[model samples]
Target chain A: MPLAKRIIPCLDIKNGTTVKGINFVELRDAGDPVELAAAYSKQGADELTFLDITATHEGRKTFVQLVERIAAHINIPFTVGGGIHELRDVERLLVAGADKISINSAALRHPELITEIADHFGSQVCVVAIDAREDDNDWHCYLNGGRIPTAHKLFDWAHEAQERGAGEILFTSMNHDGVKQGYALSALRHLHEQLNIPIIASGGAGTKNHFVEAFEQGMADAALAASVFHFGEIPIPELKSYLCEQGIPIRKL
Target chain B: MNIVILKYNAGNIRSVDHALRRLGVEATITDDHDLIRQADKVIFPGVGEAKYTIEYLRNHGLDKLLLELTNPVLGICLGMQLMCSHSEEGDADLLGIFDQKVKKFQSPSTDFKIPHMGWNTLTDTKSPLFEGISDNEFTYFVHSYYVPVCEHTIATTDYIHPFSAALHKDNYYATQFHPEKSAGVGERILKNFLAL
Candidate 1:
């Protein structure tokens, strides 16, 4: 059997608590990050991702403490993002038991950081997340939590990241995010064709069928969603069962 | 039982420590030769490039110390690769406990990624390390290089092809997958190792 398609639940954390909001606004408290991580692991999530939305200096300290707690409680591997500025931050998170570290703006600003991370740690430890939106029939990469648009094209930047030794690419379509529609299939498929590393499809995962589409059509190695898994709209076990029935290779508990 | 995780310059060693803690066993992370030698079980866990790590091991004399230990020793991911005869990653020669050569995954096509990240099933299980685990049970794997099936292979997992997922030779056991991060199945595997 081929490698099972991964189902990852993303926790947008702020001040040590998990939060979910529509389009990154009107935030609502979900629960404690550690408790949610433990529950998701029990539900057989292939991996858990905690993105520190605030990324404040104080929040970074608390986030590190939170990572330690999640590592102590959860047995599955996890990736942590947000406010990872340098090698020291990556080292700290890994030391706190994070299996992988994702970087976005910092990586875009300093492409050398990707090579540094992959060289110091390993390519498997570096995950480059790209937030891009389709503009004039071409996707343009965004930065600073999708507020500032960059001149880097989606495909070109993703390719560069892969060349720079990124293990995986987490591509989130800003247009599809928070819409509950579906992933950016064309872009994801394009990435799958252009890059050799695993591509994680993020944004616009409404139903379980959307996930199936992401895998079958988008060719995504993993599908990441924040609200659908957090709001109890779709339980991970049921989703996995549905994906399995769809002839998708999934890890069934 | 005293569990010492042979710690050199490597990533994700703490995650192994945390996993053992979840199993109610606190493993000490150290490079101390005496502590590792005295432990009932030694876990050689790592996630880094083999070339530099193997060099560090040799410089610290861990390469020879590891060979001398008679206790049950478990190697994870890069630790497993370093136990092989040689690695294609850096063309570096490693400890010859398994006699298998590690080779980088040549993606036959884009369908198979290099890292082989995500969960996959384990088959041909023969070791007590998988005592409570059944065949075709899923485990987490994240690595670019793999040891092909060999005489020492106790378990096999298929990605691009059948490769050595777990190896067993006397007191030394190694797994290409991260059993520490494989959820309940991994926890059971660790418990089985402790029972050994």
Candidate 2:
């Protein structure tokens, strides 16, 4: 069999805790990131992604400490992102025990930073996250938590990032994000067809079938969702079992 | 037992250190020639460009030290690539422990991605590294280059084609994938290596 399609649970961290308003679960009900990470790892999540949405310096330090605590608890690969601007920031995160670092806004601010990171720490360490939204008809990339827009077309920017040596492209459709209407399959398929690098399909995953479609229809190498996995709408183990039963290769529990 | 993880300018070193800690083993992360030579087992794990790592090894006189070591040595990812005679990555000349060449993974189809990233199962698992591990057990991988199947190949995996997933030559055992990051299967593999 080919490599298993990865099932990733994304944890959105704000000020050292998982942000609330992701479904009915309150911030207190969501539990700690470290405990949640350990739970997900045991529950058969292939990997985990932590997006530190904290903007304050104190929050950033807390996120780093959280990463350290989580890294000590889980054995699977974990990626840390959000507010990572410079190489020093990446160094700090990596030292704090992150397996990979995701760059979004800063990657747009200076395109050369992609090549710089790839050259220093191999392309696999560099993940260029493109948060995109459909505008008029064409998908346009956005930065800064999908608040800022750029003229870079989604497909064109994905190709450029690959050329700049990004090992993987975590393409999140802002239109599909938080809506749980399912992934932007057509756009994901288009990017998967165009790029030679792996595509991590992020945003809008509601059910086990949604993940299956992301792999079979969208040709995504991985499917990433936050609220569904976070709020128990779709447990990762049950989801993987469903995918395995549906003829999609996945790691056995 | 003294276990030393030969540290270079590599990513994933911290993860490897943590994995060892989880296994109740304290591994020394160093590039010191004498320390590496004196260790019972040396783990040559790295995640960086071949040419730059080779230059660092030579400048620090660790290249000669590595070539002379008699202890069981395990290499992971770029570490495994560097153990080969040559690498197409930056056209580097490596440690030449294994008489093979590492080549970049070229996609045969438009959909095929480089780096062969994710979990892949291992077949023909005959080495001690895979003891107690089942055939076709999945392990994590992240690399654009691969060591083609040779007599030294102990396990094989298919991506663009069947390639050496694990190689063993005397005291030198290496994995093209990151076993340290491969979950329980990885921990078992590491335990097997230590048992050697």
Candidate 3:
């Protein structure tokens, strides 16, 4: 059988707690990171991505501890992102139990960082997260939590990222983020056509059909969202069953 | 059980350790031949370039030691590839524990990706390693190269072509998929390995 499409639950963490700002689940509303991670694993999430939206040097250590705690409970792949500035940071997170490391702003600043991590740890361990926003018929890449725009185009940077040895691309549309309308299917389709590596679509996932559209229209390998899964608006088991009924190849519970 | 996870500079070592911990086994991750040899069960898990890994093993004399391990040993991913006689990756020779050749996947068309990432089901799972794993249950896999089916293949997965998903020879067993990351099915497979 062919590989099944993946459903990933993203957690926007701040100061070692799941930040429920964008969605109705207030701060710490979805429970602790380790507890929520275990719940998601039991619900049959393909993987989990924990993004430390804001972190100081001390807060980074706390995040590592959180990763260690989560690792002890769950038995699935999880990626750690945000504030990953150096090779040492990646090393620390991996050693602390993160299966993969996701990088954005640092990668934009020093493209060689991608190659370096790939050379040292293989491409499978490094994920290049591209936050893109539409501007004048062109999707432009952004950095620093989608606040600063870059001169590099989305497709160009994605191509460059793969060339530099990124195993996958996690593309988030800033315009669609928190909007709960739908994914940027056109952008995702364009990327799927251009890149050979796996593409994970992120943002604007409100309903179960939004995920199906990601796979059907966007041709995404995985669909990731935070609020929908965190707030219990859509439980993972029900989502998987829905996707399976929709003829998408999902891991049966 | 005194489980020892042989460590090199491979990625996801912690993942394996964490998996065993979830199973209530505090597996030791060590390269010390003595520690590895003394363990009740040894797990050779790794994900890295074969050439560099082979070089490290040879330099540390682990290549010779692994060839002579008597206890039950389980290899994973690149660890499984390294146990083969030869690998096309980096043109590096391996431990010859399985007496097979590892070759990179050649796509018949452009529709297939090279690495073959994500979850896929396993077939012909006959080894004790998959004692409780249901047939065709999905397991996580991520690799560009694969070992063709042979007498040693205990499980097979079809992608571009049928390849060995799990291999067994006497006391040595290995899987190309990451049981540590395959969720429930994966944990069951790991538990089966421990029971063995």
Candidate 4:
């Protein structure tokens, strides 16, 4: 049976190492991407997502070496994002052994690229990574690590993405990023209500209960976080047990 | 010897590549047909709907290519389903290499969800695939459709009905569960598959 719910672990890689902090600050090295990914795979993570937060800033694709290393070690489905803007980026990521390529800025600037990726790679292999912010008025979408704002409404962009044949949506709320407050439930719900494919809810993970709430309140198919899992604040297996005790559907190791 | 994983427009190739490496069996991932054909063993895995996947193969004309392979092939989850005769999901047509039909598990009878996610036990173990593995051992699963029990039923698991958990025919074998994501037992299964 297909997984009804997913618990994903995110590793923000900068300078070939995993880093995590609020608003992308106090950047601390977690560990090697391959080592951390292998550990997570052993712990029964349903899937893994890698954000190359420094790839663009570094002006090169850092994923080829890291992704190849991880793929040579960790055996599970994983995604790669950050600095992905063209077919070459997708090609390089795929060549490095990424199961899926996620587009955010590129998807917004040239929506046709979404179709091109979908048409070439199939919708399942192309996931649109959307970073959003709630400005006390209406939800607005952001790209390039929340630097560029898209004029398209959050729900509107999600709908366009689905129409363009995106297999999944990796949504991170800028307002919630690193806050560990919780996922932006309203925006998540808005995207969920609009799209049929799976939605991986990222950012704002403070506690184990946040994962539960991401499912119960946000109705997200998956909940993703970096610090909680990296710091051992919430061991995934124990969290799964608690979720099981709560009757939440989770993939057992 | 290194096992080559054909990385086309499919799903979950990296995990398989990583699993082999963890088992100390060097694995290479590539879409080049020659490398796949030359591999000691081949694995075709997928996570999307079978029809579109089949269409993708048909579009690329790789369906016939996959069916022609003679090496020990292990298909996982969607990869396993695509090797079957047909699929109920999306009314998809499969490669039909295995004499079985992949049918969607309809909970029209009880409260069991359509896509059975999580761990379940495997029984009726027949093939060497479970050589080091135990009976009634649970593995990870994530799918809405499943292959029904047939002559190829090397193992069985009950969701609402006893369904085929694993299948075997000649050198081609498959599992509805993901060995890559199944922890150490999964690694052992991959090792077992490699040994064949």
Candidate 5:
């Protein structure tokens, strides 16, 4: 079975409200998570991902209720990330109806966490959260909500995670994030070619054509964006239709 | 008859339902064996690891039930891998319906990536899935573990090397890629599967 190109809408939630801005800095309230998630589901996004950008170790804490709201209201599979620190977090997310849990800072810190999740939930359900930056020559790893830097390079982490049994890699580029210029195609190609897992390219998606680049040029399994989705700049269904027009072989929605 | 999608503990079903609806097929997701077995077509799709999937299916006894399916059953992406004999991912025994084994595509030292995500072609094979499908045609893929070419290999694609793209044994048919997310060619395959 071939994996289909996915157009995902990222809802950055803060204190139960769905919000989106740029580069994880500007704080603009979009609406209710349930409402936004329902709309995306209706629009034919392959999947919906909710990142609690505000739910940090000190910011708010836990997104059980928010995840439950999205899961209960909408039937589509949505991944929840941010402040996910342990196996318990994975269980809680699953119990709350999150079909997948994405670990950003946590996975980088504790690579074994991926194995624990795979041991319990399965590799497909456990997605490694990679916040990357193309600096100094090679791709660098970022952690602590994309704040702290790690020693191991991205290619290393990617290969390690796959060995550790991560089913998918959700890779976001800090360079193109919030810019809307386009996806970091070079970074995407590196990950897309080197890793055997599905890489969902995040950051720097300005238009429908940007998605095409992510799929066609970048070779990403899926293209992910937050601002464009929150601002209604691009609808999920519209993007998929556009990709179909380009003959990219997306699941018709 | 209405289509029923098995929803045990996998990811990406809603997208499949949405895509099917877009194609004018009504689909309902349920773990209820009675409901699934009665459907005109049953879709069993998922993402993630294999061992836990088998357990999830075993939890609801869906593993055994899926083997008994006589109706047309379509497995997508991870769904296809789980339908095989076994997978290096978690080294778990799969449903064994396809009599094919899953192996790792990448290594700790090898440069080839795992999860093989993106569009590649089905090189050699013929089937209803490829009715209008062509050689050099690309379909999206995202998995590290792949089911090798076997007697059931209906279509094949090369990532690091050629591997099974579509597998069929008896009434069971599966693809290592997501048809729900695949565009026209993928939709054509799904439509063909439904027609089967």
Candidate 6:
């Protein structure tokens, strides 16, 4: 069988607990990170991602502890993001048993960090996540959780990141994030065309068909979402069955 | 049983330790040659560049120590690649346990992604390592280079084409996939390895 399209359930974690909200606001408690992670793994989630929504020094320490706990319990591959500033931070997270670390703002500010990470810990350990919003017809990259915009356009930055040795591109459409209509297929398709590494489509995953479109149309290697899976809007087993029925290759439980 | 995870300058060693802990086995992570030789089983697990890792092994005398071990040994991902005779990555020579060469995956077309970075199935499996595992069972993989199917191949997985998913010769065993991160099927594979 060919490689199955990955279905990753993302958890936005604050302090030490999982939280879900819209556009990174209106936060609400979901559940414990370790328990939720084990549940998702049992439900046949291809992979799991945890974004440390907490932004303080204490919170960062707490997040590391949480990562260790999740790693001790969950058996599937997982990526941890949020507040990854330097090579030391990446090293800390990986040492804590994270399979991969996602860097967004820090990567944009210092592109050399990508090369440093890849060179030091192999390319597979570095995941460059880009949070961008579509403006008119172009997509502009954002900083500080989409509050600040940068001069780096979507395609240009993504191309540059691939050149700098990013193992994968996590492209999250800020406009589609939290809205849950669908993914930005055209942009994702463009990324798939321009880059050689795997592209993970994030945001705007409201329904199972949205996932289908992301993989089939967007040409994404994986589709990631939060609220839908967190709130039980779409159970993973049923979703995998649906994708299988739709003729899409998926890992059955 | 005493198990030691041979450690070197590589990533994901802690992950291997964590996976074993979940299975109720507390493995000692070390590079000590005496400890590795004394253990009932040794896991040579790594996720890093083959060039530097092989160099590290040679410098620390692990390259020779590993070859002399008579007990069962399991290598994962980069560890498996280093067990081959040669690797195109960094143009390095490695331990020739498998009598094969590791080649980087060239995308035949745009549809096939490099790194093969997701779940894939194993076919033609024929080893005690896959005792309880069925044919075409899925395992997690994340690597750009692969060992082509050969006489020593115990299991095969097709990405660009058929390649060695698992290899066995004598007491030396290796897998290109990360069983530590492959969930249930992976756990079964590890249990089989321990039993061996």
- Model 5: share of real contacts kept: 0.25
lDDT of 1 by residue, B55-132 (tens): 999999999999999999999999999998999988999998988889998998899988999899999999889997
- Model 2, stretches more than 4 Å misplaced? A21-30
How many residue pairs in model 4 have overlapping backbones?
A: 5
- Compared with the true structure, what per-residue lDDT tens digits does model 3 show for residues A1-253? 5778999999878889887733333435454888777778887899999999765777777898998998778887889999888898888888888878999999999999999998887888889999999988999999898999999899999999999999899999999999999999999999888887889999999999999999999999999998888778888899999999999988886
DockQ of each: 0.87, 0.75, 0.71, 0.28, 0.18, 0.85
User: Which candidate, 3 or 5, has the higher DockQ?
Assistant: 3
**Candidate 3: stretches off by over 4 Å:** A21-29, B108-110
Q: With candidate 5 superimposed using the best TM-score fit, by how many Å does residue B20's alpha carbon deviate from the native?
A: 15
True contacts kept of each: 0.89, 0.75, 0.68, 0.24, 0.25, 0.82
- Assign candidate 6 its CAPRI class: high
lDDT of 3: 0.89
Docking class of 1: high
User: Tens digits of per-residue lDDT for model 6 on B1-196?
Assistant: 9999998898888888889999999999999889999999999998989898999999999999999999999999999999999999999999998889899999977688887899999899999899988887899999999999999999999998999999999999999999999999999999999999
lDDT of 2 by residue, A1-253 (tens): 8988999988889999887434423344455887777778888888899999988999999999998987777888989999888888988888898888999999988889999888777788889999999978899998788998988889988999999989899999999998888899999999888988899999889888999899999999999988888778888888988998999999886
Comparing only chain B with the true structure, the TM-scores of all models are 0.98, 0.98, 0.98, 0.94, 0.95, 0.99
Model 4: per-residue Cα lDDT at residue A83: 83
What DockQ does candidate 1 score?
Answer: 0.87
Sorted into a CAPRI-style docking class, model 2 comes out as medium
- Interface CA root-mean-square deviation for model 6: 0.9
Candidate 4 docks with a DockQ of 0.28
Show model 5 residue runs off by greater than 4 Å. Answer: A1-3, A21-30, A56-62, B1-196
Q: Write the per-residue lDDT of candidate 3 for residues B35-106, one digit (tens) a residue.
A: 999989999998889988999999989999999899999999999999999999999999999999999998
Pairs in clash, predicted candidate 2:
none
TM-score of 1: 0.97
- For model 4, what is the C-alpha lDDT against the true structure? 0.77
Say which prediction, candidate 1 or candidate 3, comes out ahead on lDDT: 1
lDDT for residue A94 in candidate 4, whole number 0-100: 78
**Model 1 agreement with the true structure over A1-253: per-residue lDDT tens digits:** 7899999999988988877742322223336777677778888899999999875789889999999998888989899999988999998998888989999999999999999999888899899999999988999999998999999999999999999999999999999999999999999999998889999999999999999999999999999998988777888999999999999999988
Give the DockQ ranking, best first. 1, 6, 2, 3, 4, 5
**TM-score of every candidate:** 0.97, 0.96, 0.95, 0.78, 0.65, 0.97
